[model samples]
Target: MSKIYVLDTNVLLQDPHSIFSFEENEVVIPAVVLEEVDSKKRYMDEIGRNARHVSRLIDSFRGNGKLHERIPLENGGSLRIELNHRSFQQLQDIFIEKTNDNRILAVAKNLSLEEETKEDGKTVILVSKDALVRVKADAIGLLSEDYLSDRVIENDHVYTGFLEVYTAKETIDRYYEKGEIQASEIVTFPLFPNQFLVMKDALGSSASAIGIVDKSRKKLKKLIFDYDHIWGIKPRNVQQTAAFELLLRKDLPLVTLTGKAGTGKTLLALASGLLQTEDHGAYKKLLVARPIVPVGKDIGFLPGEKEEKLRPWMQPIYDNLEYLFNVKKPGELDAILAGMGSIEVEALTYIRGRSIPDQYIIIDEAQNLTKHEVKTILTRVGEGSKIVLMGDPEQIDHPYLDAYNNGLTYVVERFKDQMIAGHVKLIKGERSGLAQLAADLL
Candidate 1:
């Protein structure tokens, strides 16, 4: 049976093309959702861009038929703009506020009642990204669900970029002696390009070796880089060691790192970027950029130039740089950065519409970005450039994004099979024991 889906404003803002997602079902848009989307169209962020796109998409539908009436969609579903059902009397006992959320719920509830009176009763569902809106919908005895079209992977099943295999004691010894082995000899399953392996002895022995699949040679080679230390910072755990190998590789142009705070995701990326750009002269510059998502209460419209204003948002980057460079005194790091002239720190906002060539680009806090935004950033990379996207998917600050749908996880899942791309999920938190416990238990 065809269902009626009432889309919330956040659903449209999260993905402008959500109207066409429900196939062979009726999509209802309350007038209040358009009002909310209109109010957000003036901002200069991703949400605002999506709101404007949604308006354009709605406008395009008008040429076919009246949106207020049932308009046939390409996917066999119908679209309608609901102007009535604004009455809040039905939900007055449950929610007193006549806010946009409440108004949306009112329309959904009204549709539900109308559907129940039909001879063939159809389901009326409210599709929203807002948790509170979905909760209120449930309180009022309505069916609601999250917009799951954009989710790339489940949290528990996220790719860890490495696997373990048990081999015979002679095979393990031969691998250690020769420092390489055919992938088919180790495991019957096909291995992804650049995928790391933990080869253990099958005789219940303690011998083991870390190797990565070299797709070009079709062989598993031992790690070449010294993981004990890189640019004065050492990998505290095996996962970090795996991440470092991905970061320092010149063959893999695209690398992604996912971990909670203090897992050394950003630190490892920056350390490798600096090592290649400064020490090895492999790239022209080390460019660091991150999304400008605010935490807690936003500090609106600070007084200063671009760099001065960005100082607050980019402080975490500076802190990591200071630790790597060992700048203890005030203004010391700033002086060094100024003198070196090889490092550039900017917001992701200004990164658009430019081709960056021969640079080691690091985009931090990438979990807050959508898939389209990440695509834009990746397309801007010019020839002979490497880009590293690092973030903790669980710590997303974007209201519309979750652990599975954010850009970082999206890239990790989409690029798992590609030879030029690699990913590592850092499990250990080197920040402190307290932080590690909190990440695990809390």
Candidate 2:
């Protein structure tokens, strides 16, 4: 039996193309969902952009039939902006308010009852990205689920960008002696390009070697910048060494670093960017940007221009910079940043419609970005530009994003096999003992 999938406003705002995700099944967008989406068509953020995109898409679909009627999608399914079944009579006892969420519940609840009387056994399920909406659906006896089409990797199988393989003592010795070895001779499982491998002795000895797979995936070569200190910062572990290799390399323009907080994802990227820009003169400037997704209550409107307004959002970047420069006095970091005209700290919102060239770009808090938002940023990279995207995928602040589907995790998986990309997952937290314990236990 075919199912009827009702979409929430957040589902469409998360992925505008989600209307065609259901295969050969009816997709319903409650009328209240449109109202919610319409209310967000301005303000110029990612959500507003997605709202406008969804509006254009539904308008394009109107060529076939009216929105209230069944509009045939190209994927052999149908879309209908449900105008009926919005009666709050059934929900009056349970829900006190007539909010948009309640109205969506009303539609889904009524659809289930209407479908139950049919001989076709059509099941009704409300597809929402909001947990509370799904909970309300269940409280009112409705089957609901999260939109899963954007999940690139499962939760347990999150990509760590590296693997451990135990090999014979001779193999490890030969690799160290020769500086390279054929990957097929050692790794029995599938491997991707630029994937770091830690070769340990199968005899349970203390001997171990680390190397990254070559672009051809046929050979594993030794790391180039493993032990070197860049910008007075040394790698505390093997994962950080691998990240430095990717960061300093001019060939691989795209690098991704993922781990819990205090793994030094932002610090390492900044150090490498500074090394290449200030010492090596590899790029013209160092550009750092991050999405302004807050963790808790926002500070509300600030009274200043763009740079002053962005100071709060960019404070973490400044903190890393101050630590790197060993600034002791108040506002000393600001003076240092002003002296070095090559360093630019910016918010990701202004990055649109820009073509950045000959710069070392770092996007921190990348876990808050959507797939489309990441694509927009990546496409801005011009010739001689290298971009590093670093974030803790497990610590996302965006309401519509999770670890598996955020932009950082998406890029890590999609570019794992690509030649221009390299990724590392920093497991150890180097910030402090308490920080590492909080990261692991709490």
Candidate 3:
């Protein structure tokens, strides 16, 4: 007997194709889930797009049979809409609320109880992205699990975009003298495109060198900007040196930087953007954008005009800009930015319809973005544009996103092997001792 997997509304909103994730098992969708999806269908944001997508997908399934009954899915499983709310009243004794979450849990509990009387009783598992819903289900003696199909890396440690290997001291010297070496001669492990490496001496000597694999994955080349200062900010460590290698490379169109707070992810990206666009004359402009989490499409709640409403959300970027420009006045940086048409800071809200070309784009705090939201932003990159997405996967603000499942993590894993894409994970925080201590301890 196949197990029954009941889904939550968040699961569908996170991934519209998640209904087919449970293979060869019964997939149950509570009626309240559809109602919740309906309420969000007009949201005009990522959730809204996902809600509309789910609505259309279910409507197309009607051609097979009625949704209330078992509808055979192509994955060898059946989909059903549970219209009964028999367990809702029982949950009131414990939950004391009639929210949609409780309603969905009640449906799952009702099915679990009904299956217990059968000779070939099937196991019921409630799958939800919400932790509280699972807790409520556990209180009612029901089995529950997270919907983890969207997770990029299932391990505790995500892909760090770099590797450390112990090589013979001779190999390190030879690599430095020749400026490049055959990747097979260094390590036995598989080499990925643009994968940064820190080669250490195996003889217990104090010798080390940094390099990265080319797109062909055959040669390891030394860092190009290892010593040069990028817009008055030099590489403070080997990680930043590796980052500048990717950031200044016009050949690579996509770059992702992930690290803890105060690690200079945004600072380095801004410095590079300024150097390339203003000094090198590589791109036309520097465009910076980040998501306004929790209030994604509903910025009307904040008072003032569009720019005023966005000030709070965009302050972090401005703070970094001020540090780079050394502006002592309150609006001095703003005035300089206004005069310099080459730099633009804006929210990710209206980025859907525009085709950004010949620009250096930076998307900070990218972990707050959903997969769909990031995909939309990525598709807007046009010819001659280089997009840098940097964030701490450990710090996510989206309710439905976790460390390994947000847009930044998703893109890091998905594009790790692409020739045009590169990634670097900054470990040490260069901001300050206090900030680094807070990032690690607090």
What Cα-based lDDT does every candidate model obtain?
0.91, 0.92, 0.91
Top of the candidates by lDDT = 2
TM-score of each: 0.96, 0.97, 0.96
Per-residue lDDT over 191-278 for candidate 1, one digit per residue giving the tens place of the 0 to 100 score:
7888898988888899888899887637999887875687898888778888888889898889999988889898899999999999
Model 2: residues with Cα > 4 Å off, grouped in runs: none
Clash pairs for candidate 2: none
Best by TM-score: 2
lDDT of 3 by residue, 208-324 (tens): 999999988999998777646876788888889899989999999999999999999999999999999999999999999998875445545788899888898899999999999
> Per-residue CA lDDT of candidate 2, range 1-442, in tens?
7789999999999899999999999999998899899999995888998999999999998889898999988999999999889999999999999999999999999989988897876899999999999999999999999999988876668677788899998999999999999998788777888889999999999989998899888899998875457778899998998889999999999999999999999999999999999988999999999998888998798888999999999999999999899999998988888988999999998999999999999999999999989999999999999999999888988988998888988899899879999888999999999999999998
Comparing 1 and 2 on TM-score, the stronger one? 2
Superposed Cα deviation of residue 256, candidate 2 (Å): 0.6
Model 2 C-alpha RMSD to native: 1.4
Query: Candidate 2, residue 226: CA error in Å?
Result: 4.1
